[model samples]
Target: MTPPKLRRLATAGLIAALLAGPMQAAAAQEPLVDHTPGQADIEGGATAQQDTNSLDASLSDAEKTADSVLTVDQMAANQRALASEIGPDGSSLGQGIERLATTGDPQVAPVDADAPTGTAAVSYWRPSGVYGVDVSSHQETVDWRAARNQGSQFAYVKATEATGYINPFFSPQYGGSEAAGMLRGAYHFAIPNVSTGAQQANYFINNGGGWVNDGKTLPPLLDVEYNPYPSLGNSCYNMSAAQMVSWIRDFSNTVVTRTGRLPMIYTTTDWWNTCTGYSTAFADHPLHIANYNNSGAGTLPAGWTGYELWQYTSIGPVVGDWNQWPSTLSALQAFARNNTAPAPSAGSAAITTLAGRTTKLGGATSGVVCGLIGGGCYQNYQRGSIHWTATTGAHATLGAIRTTWAGTGYEKGRLGYPTGPETCGLLGSGCYQNFQRGTIHWTTATGAHATLGAIRTAWAAHGYEKGRLGYPTGAETCGLVGGGCYQNFQRGTIHWTSTTGAHATLGGIRNTWAGTGYENGRLGYPTGPEICGITDGGCYQDYQRGAIHWTTATGAHATLGAIRRAWAGTGYETGSLGFPAGPETCTLVGGGCYQSFQRGAIHWTTATGAHATTGAIRRAWAGTGYENGRLGYPTGPQTCGLVDGGCYQNYQRGAIHWTTATGAHATLGAIRSTWAGTGYERGRLGYPTGPETCANNRCTQTFQGGTLTWTPTTGTRITYK
Candidate 1:
């Protein structure tokens, strides 16, 4: 199908899905702001402040009852309200379709000297194996050993273009490939308007030829994206697909004649149709395609067997690995060979680790250090069990240190054992006293070692936590791996405010808090110098303040707990909610709604649903009914506080119209709820001016536009205004 056709289908699907869900309602228990009932007073101190505020005369629970549920008639009204906001000229659909269908340009290149000499073997295409680089645009260095350990063998480095225009991102990737010791190749972006094929070839040959190793270099690739002709601003808009194909062909042929390497095409699917007509002009050559979703391949023009490489998705983090690309090294090598057949090499030796120490049975010994104090290293800086070692022989002892994860992550060492105490005798003072101080003594034949105060307390061990102090402290702390005292001095200690009930805290010089429940009904177990106390009190039970008034129950019918107004709460919200950094709007009590005013996203509370906007931008969109300065207001039969899709279901923006799936209608932004099962859920309003559906008890369920559909399960509700 054409791009336009596909977009139309997508748009329809999106619209259908939007209209079916029910609008949610406002929260019944809009938490009282800072109400401290019968707060106890300290002796001879100021009295505790009580919550005092006039009730909103125009706003009450009963006043909102009428606007809660949305009827089918209201749905139509919502559609009309949004009609003007969606599509060009208020049409039912936007721009008809996404794009038109067309032909892509044919590509030609010099026969690759590195191409396999044997006849190309036909093979079935299957999505198997990993394809990734040892280094990437983000990493400045690469570890060959680590790469090899992670199974990396193939690499792609960035190259240059002619006309003096270079890829803004280079240097690091170019050098990292060598550091990684992976088989390598390079590619140049087809810079439209500036560099012709010859220019690109000359630039690459001059700056990138060294990347090839005999026949090992992967085939050259051409990145062709946006059209580059400056004079064709809108010209390409009306140009036939055939024309686009011609331009690409001209560019392709120029580079091939100069480089003596087959140039593969790298482009998006839409660009393919506009320039290649999905024809066989370059059918024999490899094609690297970037289709974020796997669903679009079947729609490829006829005669296309399969892509040489496919970038199916982005942003995947595999365990024990690094790189933004989605595939692994072995898979990359296979993909380079087009998975026709396999060649063999013995796998690298296995690495053994104990107690957080590692050692390769046959790996070299030059990098090991022997004097490390701790047997295991942690990622954070805090003290742990320190173990010192000293070498005693010519063939020095070699071994690895293990971390909590049971891996040999780093190396350690120590000097040869003392030849004799007399050989190091002069190191001590001349005071020849030798007296025991407890179980140990600082003494020598020549003199007693410097007084106890002279010994420096350096960190000898580290643990899995971060930013721990030297020596044992009753406070919670952990150390980072590699024997650091603390991860960084900056993230020292994170303190929180007082909280009611049994709130636990971590303690100990090692900062181990994984265990559950406090000892003796206290916050955490005391260790060394560390101790736990109530949030409002100082460390240890001694400094705890007497009971505060907020703890007293106000009775069964009365509401309790913190409630954010205007904006929602997120990330340790203790005081009034603050403004966000993005777009926002505000609302008045009864009417008046506007859109598109720059404003800092804000979180505010109102006595009677007053209109206000304050945040990033100076100006604010105007509206009402708990406007968080977002798009619209919340509407549903159930109390808005109901949690759905990981966010509170009741939050909504105020008075802004956008195209709803049902047609043009007011756009009611959905609120994310922390209580929702994994992610965020959508909510809407009941009343509007057009053909749209408001959320309600009858229809609040996520709909598939009458057909089954998938929505993001993980959503965020921690929005401000």
Candidate 2:
């Protein structure tokens, strides 16, 4: 008996011839004889006289008279006849002979003609044209060359199962079959219960399920059948027929998407009908049926028009399962080429045509149809894609501009579908693509930019590239404080907060806004468009928290929060406190805030809201240490007409008084009461000469009419001259 490895070598030689080309027809004149035990004799050969009880004498008279030098058609018929006798189980005269021949165990007793074969049998119906076999580790190693020489025309080798589990014999069997000139394909045994169909398909393709359009390679095959669970009594596992069908479809679709070739289906008729409910969705894919009964090709699973390859018997001239393709070699080759070719779908025809016309796109690298988004299709290439839409037709997007568009959400994003092809030779040798919603611009200096919605409208109104704003430099960004969006331009920025709508800020106003921390500063976000016709023809833009006022007089100043409100209350620049003279300064004396205006200045502290002081009143308050001095932040605006026709403003600590008699002076505590009692400036003791002269633990201020003094020990005293 031949060793398993040696047998495999011999088989490899036989199968190699089938893959290389058509087999040479055997000469009709040669006489043939069966040399092994349990053998048959061919016509024109002398009969061997052996004991009837021995294996060699078991052949029927009809088998003994079979023709030895047979045509391809004749060989296919004989294989089918023998497979019918074996059936699905290893029973009958045919299976007995095959087991004795393959395993070389002559002592094993033969089963009755109608008994089960223990092993699953291939279909019995013989296909009249080409023939082949599928193999796995179960066959150990195959004599592929011998199998091909004996009339096998093609082979499908088991490659992977589930996510893991690779067939050890796959490499040798695949190479041996291919080398023997057989049309070869790889198959995956799907375990849908263990993992998803897509995952298994990916694993299968990555391992050995992939196929090219080379004439010798066949499309991949999927082997989905009875579940391998031992404890379960049913073959369908826990899934219903519909679920099984869905699993099979998912696997087939995934395989087609990755390899661009729909896989052939390998399943028995009963399993297909019962487990998959006779699903017809996969009718377009080729079928490889396994039905081991003698009924021939009378019935098939629903959906399939006819079978391509039929696995007819577990035992063949070689030591592996046998199959047959019911067509001539030329027809088989054409089928392979057609199935592996790029087949167009609904919207893909236009994209396919576009790709053919464009030289740079090369060929499509992916088979995913773009129908999921828009009513279009896209075929991706090395550089870009050939995008097709019913309305926009077909166009090509490539290079940096394409990259930029993809960054902005591709077709599903704000840009939507490409309306026009990429155009070059713009202002700076740039390129751009127009989309349904907006346009993407690209240049060496600016890279690629997207401008859309209101921001784009504003940019266009400003003359776009020719205007002061120049070209856009970035995509529009949202999620601003006031539901606003913004995009940067070459010369400046366009802001679109809710209150301000869409507006552009440039030059000094832009600079001043930046210095004040832009939107993040005390001014917050812009609330309204900038106004140009304020007091002195100044421009001011309102913000969420306050406003920034700009003019030739004040440059640009931001007045916000309490101080801004105080200024607004005074009629802004039109009333007393005119345009801001300077930006608001805070963290001042006594933790106060202040801003200077054309008329006067407004100061505020936590204790004192905000009050304005001007002219001599402001000077008087400043002299008294302002908020930090004896007279703190003003408690009220200045008022005229005291007892002596003087003006005074109250503060947190004291008050400042001004009159013609004594300019401005701060009168506080007991001195203020004493002065007021003496009729202040109206009576004889008029305004004080100076602040206060202190010595010998006494404080005194000499009035115009008399001298007033105070001490802790003496309380108060007045000296009149």
Clash count of each predicted structure: 104, 26
* TM-scores, all models, native as reference: 0.29, 0.51
Tens digit per residue, CA lDDT, model 1, 1-721: 2232111112333333322344322222221111211212111112212112201112223222222223333334333433333222111000111111111111111144112111112231124443444222323344544554454444555465333444343555554443333445666644332323454556665666332212235666666543322121111211223333444455456555765446766665554443333334555566666543334333442234776555433322221112222345444445444443443211111111221342222333111212123222111111211122222111111211112111211222111121111111222321111111100112223111111110111111222112242222222122322211111111122222222211222232112222212222222322222332423222321112111111111100100121112332231112222222222233533342322211222332332231223321122123332344444433321112322211111234423222233221232333212212222223232222232233432112122122111234532222121
Q: RMSD to native for every prediction?
A: 39.1, 18.6
- Model-by-model lDDT, in order? 0.30, 0.66
User: Which ten contiguous residues of candidate 2 have the minimum total lDDT?
Assistant: 1-10
Least lDDT summed over 10 consecutive residues: which range in candidate 1? 551-560
Q: Which ranges of candidate 2 are over 4 A from the true structure? A: 1-189, 192-374, 377-398, 420-433, 461-463, 478-485, 494-521, 574-577, 581-583, 597-600, 640-646, 659-662, 678-721
Segments in model 1 whose C-alpha atoms lie over 4 Å from true places: 1-128, 133-157, 177-184, 209-211, 214-216, 228-260, 294-296, 301-303, 317-721
User: Candidate 2, residues 193-212: lDDT per residue as tens digits?
Assistant: 44556777888999888987
Question: How far off is residue 367 in model 2, in Å?
Answer: 11
